[model samples]
Target: MRCLWLLGGSYLAAVDSARLDLSQVAKDPTPLCHEDIVDETCELLSAGRNVFQRGPSGKARVLSFGELQGALHTTLDSLASYMDFIDLDPHRAGPFMVNCMELCSLTVASLPLTHRPPAPDVACYTSDAGVVCDIDVSDASFSNISFDTANADGTNKFEHSTAVKVTVEMGNDTVWSPDVAPVDPEDRDDMPENVGLDQLRISVANLFRIFPPFELEVTESKNLDDVSDPQIVEENGTDAREVEVAIEVSPTHSPTDIVGSGDELELDLSDHEQDDAAVGAGTGEVASKRKRRASTDGEDSPTKRSSGSVTEAAVTAAELRSLLGEHLREIKMAWGDIQDRVTAVEKVTQGHKKELKVVHGKTKVLDQQMTAVKAKGDATARKAEDLETKLEGLTSKIEELGIKNQATGDGSDPWGEYLARRKEGQPGRSEGGEERKSLSEEDQRSLILGGWLADTKRSIIESEAQQILDMPALANFVDTNRVVVFGPRKSFGILRFKIRDGETAAGVKARMWEVVNHVRQNKQTLSSTTGLGDEGRPMWASFLKTPEARKKSAMCSMTRRVAMRLAAGVKTKEGAYYNEDATTVAGYDVDWSTGTVWSGTHKLASASHRKDISRNDDYQALKLGWVDIRAVVAVTGCDWSEAHEAFQHEQ
Candidate 1:
């Protein structure tokens, strides 16, 4: 039965109407060709020959579809076995097989016809899309095209005179169709039989006019899958047998056309071998092995062919040379790819080095900042230590000053004494028996400066004092000298002198009132001054109003001996006696009218009769005198009758 073929959306008769015997087709090494469809198959053969021609006077003869199909089926079976070995998807195998058959058919159908066939070396390989075949056609008539440079249109221009190497590629998901125009049905009846043949040849030739060979079929949908199982049809409402017709066409680049380095090629081979081992284990079949054709006297041994059982014609010397040349081109491409990979790796290394340098710089900056912070911390610690030392010294100096004030009788509470004098209406009098006058502002300032200088052991000078007064912080408080003078004096001598004159009580009162009013006027200035901080300077009113000061002011003043006696609750005068010149008398009589004491009719000498009473004995005698008794009575504010009764009882 004649096999039908689809081309350009139409069914076409193959090379012969008679059925091809499978047995004869398989046994025959040379392909059978017929005159009627020679143009169609030769048209495809010419396109492959254009890119690669072998030997001088290179030519190709017509091939029958049966022989072409058988060879392609063998290649397809080998590819399927390899795909199975590599564990590819089972669904893709059917489509991939169909696509490979169609692509091979298109290639074989594009060659020029000749009487004598040129021997070509053919090899098939697995590609990303499917299988690809490389046919050595280096002897074809039009294989001398060269590309020296690209044209202005961004296309590589060809010159037919020089020998050049070229590659053609067809992308995935693309469609292709013959460029034949529609024949006019009316004109077809009058047209010569050869005229239609000539038109077909021209249409096939037009397909290869552009570089890279294949043309895109823009009108067809890209999602078409002609390899799917065909739908069944019913005849007379009865179910007919299921009929499946599938033909798929796809494009791909040759092995030389795939640009890559030797490393990538090796990686691809390793991946294939690994997959082959896996699938082979599952299927219980040994993975295929590569066979290197040993050269004997520079000729490919006839025995060393592919592992497939299909018989092929003996390879000629020219075909062997062509295969070697193809291998050489592959080596050159791999070297170029390796160089490109090396350059890219170097660029990445440089980028990493620059990043490391940046990190190092940042680390150094951080280190420097840490060092500065450490230094600041150390300086702060030293300052704190110095402050602690100064505080200790001030504490010791204050203790020493306290001891000295107590010894010199200046430690007595002057604030209490001043309050007492006010209550008694005894304002202080100077040595001249006149009331002391308040000092002028200049004299007060001078006194304050002199006192401070003496306390600090610094030389007192008018210029220095005026300079201190002229300071911006102190300028406004220049007239407030009374407040400073009344404050706790550091010098015991000055404090003693002030206490003796008793001029500080009224002055302190008046100065305190003035300070209160001044503070009110300068509240903002005083509060804002940096020297005073948030609370401002202490006022005399607040200081003197403390609990200790108030408690001291409330207490009554008495001599130490009288206070001791009162505290002991001694109401009787049992210890009253008179002692003089180492002689002691137990009984004493006080002559209240004459202010004299008599001891057993012997007149006791009073303390005032001695010229020096600094001795302890003289001091004791002074306490025994009637004068001291009268003075105690006056100080205690007791009635004279009670005092006389106490003395009379003692007598």
Candidate 2:
């Protein structure tokens, strides 16, 4: 009665033939990804901005679907060179049909500052077959295996951010339950080592996140109890069960080979996860595209039909080809929609600008009017205050006279009579007999300050927002490191850094992969998926997978898709090689040269000294990967001002 463990997607079900339970697993969606065509909204904003920037002479470039297609081509071409694989599209269709995967090669190459994570962090295998990646791991995206750089005595391993939720069930020898933790195995001790023997059978279902860019949502959890349930059988098979073991994914990290408790490990077949036998041969004359079918004509082709008997209405190869084309066409339509939205956004932006001007003018007028009104109010308040004081004094005097009158007669003498009597009697009376004014009860205390009034203890307002960026901690790391920017694929920004001596340039390149791997795109977080109508309501951002829910694909290491580069030098010692940095910090010039990689919003977070690289105690390289860096670390001990001045004018 030994226990086994499983993670990510449906590996356990595919590999295990054992009867087991899977009751508590769940998938939660987070808005990690989305895709839209370059529409009017995107067009107007992206296109109009360039025109606005140029002011007069520059042509206002409208982004076409073709142009976008071209951009994708450009990006993919650059991306493929690093992966060293060819794109697979027999018909040379659109990228949508190709299922463009997140570029994890770049992320892996530059992260952890030394060792890179394997590719295939997140993926969607469809009805059609293919690997998410179409390239080879380059020096830009890969690192030489370091035997002694890691701190661990055992083998060093890293998992991509892709994950799945699992419940640790009770076994004769195990504790299996559900817990969601963002920490990667490389970042922490992943599964408890002493928990179980391989004899225990584990089971769970794979939940898909309906969103993209690596989000996951749990769909259903199956247990031994569900075999009798209709939904379980309807979902394909209730015959198999979950078995804990390893599953293999392809180069770009989509699940491929699955292993089990016994020898039953095999991958779950999706619409696209193909059988090895059906795959078109990897490298041959068959992959080449013919120019005859390639047409510059914009018209779409109609689907052809096949001839069979009862199912004679069944689809033919020609029809399948056409259907594929239509699918590609649908992808194109999505792209067009994106473009249209772009244009619409542009118009909205222009309208907003005009409205903004009008609003500004109104604001100015209001300010002036308010100033005058405030002055008038102050004058009125002062006048009223004076009047109030006068009234108070008069009231006090009147009260004194009333008191004297009351004392003078039982019926209370008239005011005129009291004064007459006062004059007669008081004229003879000394100063001691003269009446002094007393405050009226009405004026004893301000009504606003009474117990019945509202109570609001107002604190003095502070003048500014406190800085949340940890300045002291940032100073600590920057003082020792330099920065570089490189990628297995290109979109990395101008990286800013200060590097220490002895670190290799490749080491920096590998380390850069670590940072971009975890970039949280705003598309999901920008809006609440489960919309709230008004205030005081539950709010959630759109995502394919939530923090608790996971989308596991064995070793789904999309972390490699993000690329990074660090600044360092290459030096040769004897017959071996050495990578080193020129100085303690590489600043402005480093940023200038790589402005496209790190110059903008990206930050080098989660920096880890590759303890695995120091396994045998070699310190030349760090484990290059991303580990949840809580803050942005800068290159310290450099003349930043001077560096900026020198590179400010550079393009």
Candidate 3:
């Protein structure tokens, strides 16, 4: 009947043989609001009581008990509605839903998350046999992926990899549960060289299961054997195998407790022993058999035999703790894997980098040669230009002299032939400006430059260029596994823990100190010399060192008016505090009770705010500069004596 209802619940179950991964479908894209809403509700509810208990001041003002209580109920109701809305079965529903939802919600709200957390997904699988199985999620999937790999001994095989999923009407709604991934033949990489064949055995055991009664029909009027034949070939010409899937119904989880998807199949002989004991109690069978068999095959109190199921409440706590422990282990394992993979990539990358470096060295040599060749060519051209210029001048003068003599009707000496011969010999002129020419000096310069270039090229070849005075030798090393976490220290004016390869204090101290100082100064300026909460004097003088002014134990209108006349301070009273001018002191204000003594105004809120910021005599808070711990550490090399000494004297 239950199976029939499961089939009749809805058509969604029978629609198709999708082998759906309901885990993907049930994924919560939003952070679980469970914890956040609960926390917020609790805090808001408690806020009024806390303020009422402590004499309302600071952020405690405006808190009301009635509103907080009402808000809490509202949050719980909203959460309850959500719990009811998820389609889960009645056999597996209750406080656990509330708890799980609350946790999910709280985690989402408190953290600045960019993506939604993973939710329970459901998937079902069917074998050649008609037997249907149902799997319910009990813990986080990422925490421990039960890989379907077997050691050679055939132990630790996580079967049930491929499972289809569908939403069945649990009791509340048609909510989907977590499912498994399809069997990927290649997801398991090749085993290490040393691993035995047994260790590398990859086999599917039982990744997931589907309930009986096909929702829709993949094998209608056809048996498992009939549908086993290959229908079509895949891209690789391998037969495309398909199977009918159905929505799961049986083996539901106790939503409040540990719900294991695996089996514990040990047989109990205690019942047989108990029956024998009963017979002995009636017929004295134990007395007759007390010799040898009774000692070896013993019965441990027949009354102690367990016949009922485990309680929901008992299992919930244990499983929750187990879940947390598993989460931490996963983090460590994932980190190890990441470190290992990165180390491998680094090696390959380094090899490529080395190749590039060698190529770069070759390029540098070639560049030097090119530079030298260019210089030689430039010098040779310059030399030719100079020689041509000199030759042209000499030739022009000779031509003029010859023309002048001819005009005077004197001897035609035929000097042009001699001039041409002299020009050629001079090595500057080239065919009387018919073409270009080179100067001898320029040619000499080219040869000198070329020689220098050659020498520069030689320097790069025979020896490496100069490095640092005594540079450390470069070497290759890899740490591809675990990461070491360092201790916490003051970094950038904030208390920070150093993770392995995490941010360094040295890098951020300067900027962090600047912000801290700025905020501290502003705090001092706002609290001082005013007839605010100081009442003319500070309550804490041991920690603060502020300037002087008269203060009053009891505030009066005259004191408030006179304080305005007497000192400088900010008038930052909020709307709620308007009835009572409850603005606090910042600078040194006079304390009539102490008769005008000095004070120190420290304001480390995490410690004690009043103790840090109050003056005993004067009602003023004093501001002071601070030396950054990280910078001090860097400069001083080791001892924190300087910072500790300052902190000690700060009072």
290-394 per-residue lDDT for model 1 (tens digits): 212122234222233342423222333334334433443333333334434655797799999999999999999999999999999989976765665466556
C-alpha lDDT of all candidate models, in order: 0.31, 0.26, 0.28
Number of clashes found in candidate 2: 140
lDDT of 3: 0.28
lDDT score at residue 93, model 2, on the 0-100 scale = 32
TM-scores, one per candidate: 0.25, 0.18, 0.19
Q: Pairing residues by index, what is the TM-score of model 2?
A: 0.18
Range of the 10 consecutive residues with the lowest summed lDDT in candidate 1: 262-271
* Cα lDDT, model 1, residue 433: 43
Q: Which candidate's lDDT is highest?
A: 1
Which of the numbered candidates is closest to the native, going by highest TM-score? 1
100-170: candidate 2 lDDT, tens digit per residue: 22222222222232121112212222112322211121222112111111112232222221225442322
Candidate 1 residue runs with Cα over 4 Å from true position = 1-247, 252-254, 258-379, 382-513, 525-651
List, residue by residue over 1-651, the lDDT tens digit for candidate 3. Answer: 011112111111111222334455455332223344334333332232323232334232121212211222123333233334443221242212222233233333332222222321222233345423322222332122111123234432233343355333333334333223322334422111121111111000000011222222222223322222344222314321222222232221111111112311111122123112111111111111110111122422212223231210122222443443343233233334443465579779999999999999999999999999999998987676566546655664475555446554566554565686777774223435333332222111110001011122222211221111012221111111111111111101101211123434343343334433433443322112235555332111111111221112222222322222222222224523221221334322434443331112322111112332343332222232222333323322333554334433443
